[model samples]
Target: MDTTRSLVYIAFCAAVIAVLAQVMIPLPLVPITGQTLAIGLVVTLLGKKYGTQAVCLYIMLGAIGLPVFTAFSGGLGVLVGPTGGYIIGFIPTAMIIGLYFEKFGYTYVHAVIANIIGMFVTLLFGALWLKLFANLTWSAAFISGVLPFMIAGIVKACIAATVGLTLKRRLQQAKLLQIIQ
Candidate 1:
């Protein structure tokens, strides 16, 4: 892609992440958010490099105090606070899922698998950060950080994969796939 189109894709995906972060559930420790689904969608659509850049841009916006984080909150404080790891976790999540599509192929099955694995990595980082920042024990961290999100993660991954593949196929058919990976 050209420089303009690449930048546009990054900016657009970053905006999508911001928009998705608004759908928060306001839980006690970590709010249930649409971020994972958004990451899955962006990675499946943009591939590794562009997708990672988009996520990084999203983080940079949040780091600079943009209200792009969950619960419409942002800033360095939010990024380093109790739930910040999940926010930071998007980087690797995008990389993992996007890498799968680029390395293997952009199939529905691959998307689903990649998304699931990415979700797990996010959970791992989230739980670890929760343990450290919240001063919770490992079990407690697992309970609060991972347990509640398990089912939702699977559902979100499936939704992202299904939608991603459908949209990808449509784009390919329309010859607009050249703009993407």
Candidate 2:
């Protein structure tokens, strides 16, 4: 597509992430948020280039104190906070998911697999950051930061994969979004 349209898609996806970040199940350490689901959708729909751009834009917005992160939190402090790793991790997660689709086919199975992997990638980043920043042991981090969200993350991945692929297909058919990997 044209540059203008691509940028619009990226900006729109970033907004989607910001909006979805508010849907959360509060936890002591890191709340379960729809940010991941939005990430999955953005990458699945936009592929590597635009998908990664969208994630970066979202992170930059939050880092600049835009209240775009979970719980309406933002600013550099939030990025360096215990939960910041997950926010930062969204970048690689989007790239990896997009790469997965680029290499493999954009089928439902592939989308689900890529999204699950992306979830794990984000969890790994969050757990590691939680351990170091919070001064918690590995076991403590796993229990508090990682384990609680596994099931929920899986469910979100599946939902994102399903919805993302469906929307991508429909958009392409309608000539709304350009054909993506």
Best by TM-score: 2
Q: Please write out the lDDT profile of model 1 over residues 58-177, one tens digit for every residue.
A: 999999999998877889999789888898888988998887888888877888899999899899989999999989999999999999999999999999999878876787788766
lDDT agreement of model 2 with the native: 0.92
Every model's TM-score: 0.95, 0.98
Please list the C-alpha lDDT of all candidates, in the order they appear: 0.88, 0.92
* Residue pairs whose backbone atoms clash in candidate 1: none
Count of backbone clashes for each model?
A: 0, 0
TM-score of 1: 0.95
Model 2 earns a TM-score of 0.98
RMSD from true fold, candidate 2: 0.8
Q: In model 2, where do residues sit more than 4 Å from their true spots?
A: none
